[model samples]
Target chain A: MKIEKEPISGQYGKFKIDGIDYRVYWEEAGQGIPLVCLHTAGSDGRQYRALLNDKKILEKFRVIVFDMPWHGKSSPPENAKVGNYKLSTDFYISQIMSFINGLELVKPVVMGCSIGGRIILHLAINFPDKFRALIGLQSAGHLDPYYDISWLHRQDVHGGEVCGGIAYGLMAPTSPESDKFETMWHYMQGGPGIFKGDLFFYKFDGNIGNEIKKIDNSKCPIYLLTGEYDYSATPEETKSLADTIGIEMIKMKNVGHFPMSENPKEFLKYLHPVLNKIS
Target chain B: MFKSLIDDNEKRSQLSIMAQYLNTSFMISTIENEYLVNIEKGVVKNVEEGPFVMPSYVFKLTAPKDEWLKFLKHTPQPGSHDIIAMLRRKVLKFEGDLHPLMSHLLYFKLLLASLRPVENKNEN
Candidate 1:
């Protein structure tokens, strides 16, 4: 499926939630339940435009996606203090709760990627009753050994090398459409510092893991989805997370981080089964 | 001089065949150990000094032209696949005929498939 650019209707528009101006970008399609889509960090809801506009997905449910603070057309915080450092998990959770409540959404299925996935985990833990189902893509809530070390050194030393590796390494083998693919690749990057801060929040101590354990105790059902070659989070770590939380985890082979962007067809094939179970 | 003429004639024919088959132009920068292939209008231009060890993503070229030329100071030996591979990875960048360039890029995989050295079963 092609990624089509759709203009956002000011359904929710810019509203203040606890002193922060939040711009919610949303489009409603199909009928059934409302699905709230949270994009990866540095990415606005635009990343999910393809999924939102998909004929099959649109036929099933109404999709709502909003840009997180400091991301995509969303208003920056009133205070630069919050902007100085990365946005904390607590800050994000508060914003999400406000967004949901402001929109009057009824415990919609929460789906997120990377940092968005982490937010879903937090939401599930703190506010278990808010969502009917949870979908985490290449999620970062798991406590992995590799995640303990700060990538600050790599950022300082490797810089663009690591950036290029993580960014371009995800694409499939070269095809005739390499140039077009390159354009897409350039657009996918969250610039330099933005991505660094995003990763930092993702690996912030064992907060996410601790939160997940709480979610397990609360008996919140969550579906963990990821690609095979997702170096950021290994399959072993994912399996461990599933075993720890006793939740179903589906691994898509021949893919990497951002599988939805890389191979949406394969992603949907795996995603539909879990979504069906939830529905 | 007579031998050189025969060699040039053979080389010209060989170059034509290589161009038609590969559909890309290859340039190698030895200093950076990078090779850049210019594919214009679905045709591969040069094929001899490539397939070298370089960073991937041919479109994101980093080296400047002067530095690249300096890197190629010494005459390059023939039959270096590494240079072409390097070019495919895009250590250097070039601008040429757009249509042919795209054609060359699109047929990269096919060109690579065909360019594999034939196994010398008789020798080894």
Candidate 2:
């Protein structure tokens, strides 16, 4: 039988953040400038699979993706209680820093989407020197809750399917069917209440309205890329954030909330230029 | 038009796997019209146009004709792209029990999305 294997590698390592032991799983491909990609809420590092395998991007950047604890292949902390996964700003920052320090990455360019996108702002404001550049996909200072998240973790509902269903609408209708479904599949596999737990940080704990003003773009240049169809983090929201911070917002057409995963080909078209400028 | 499109066998087969256990009815109301759709075990049994005094449906989704027109476009604008988007923008009103809708969200979402007009390939 003929076999074809991807040019990607996966490894699991132990990281201690805030005195908790987490067996984190990460995937890496390519070489050159270090690029750390953070996935969306309730999803995992698999969101960056298309980016990790792109030949052109691989030629210029060493792309790395890691699943946060309680997500994907990364098991929750051994000593933790069940269904108690709440992400706080300090906890999120410490985890990223620990992961970077553990991997010995020096000033890697940090890029994140959705909740991951919001965290990059916190990172920029708190640890400006840690990253070479900050890229926020579907990022905004705050998001108003649309639907009752109580449905997400309720026993009466199928958490995974409902979660996937909610995210399905966030993609542009023009995106390829296979890619859109794949992005939904990630949400479908999320643990119970995990999406809502992450939202605790997204909707409430992680509001950066006041702190965003402190981020000096000259020191750690901030780039915001928002999909036009992302209702959660609409183009208006990103544009407002950009205007507030005195930076330009790049609006991606025919894309939506989960740009990297839902329409990677379209996303790369917007990304390549930014990476070239960063390089 | 909504009835014939949703009741197609191929369309029913494309619904989410969880639809197999769903047996519910809902109403879709545009500004000037209302259509009551009945589903039993994932199959679209019937769709009836209505001005009934008190129609029986688990839930009702109401949106203006213009909003529905936008939603039915082959590639709708951002805020009109999906039910949730419209709900977020307060353009679509969802009334009645949400349990059935939220429990089988994928099924309902796909069911509604299937109504979008198919693009014409020969357009100049």
Please state what fraction of the native interface contacts candidate 1 reproduces: 0.00
Which one is best on lDDT?
Answer: 2
lDDT of 1 by residue, A7-112 (tens): 3343547777677576655655555677888876555666675576667676667788887766666656566443254657767777777877887889688888
TM-score of chain A considered alone, across all candidate predictions:
0.80, 0.98
The residue ranges of model 2 lying beyond 4 angstroms of the native Cα positions read: B121-124
Provide the overall lDDT of each model, using Cα atoms, as 2-decimal numbers: 0.54, 0.89
TM-score of each: 0.61, 0.96
lDDT of 2 by residue, B1-124 (tens): 3655455655556774668888988998986888899988877788998777889999999999888878877778888989999999999998999888999988888787777767734321
Per-prediction DockQ comes to 0.04, 0.87
Looking at model 2 chain A, report the run of 10 residues with the lowest lDDT sum: A76-85
Which is the leading candidate under DockQ? 2
Superposed model 1: Cα runs more than 4 Å off: A1-12, A79-85, A142-165, A171-192, B1-124
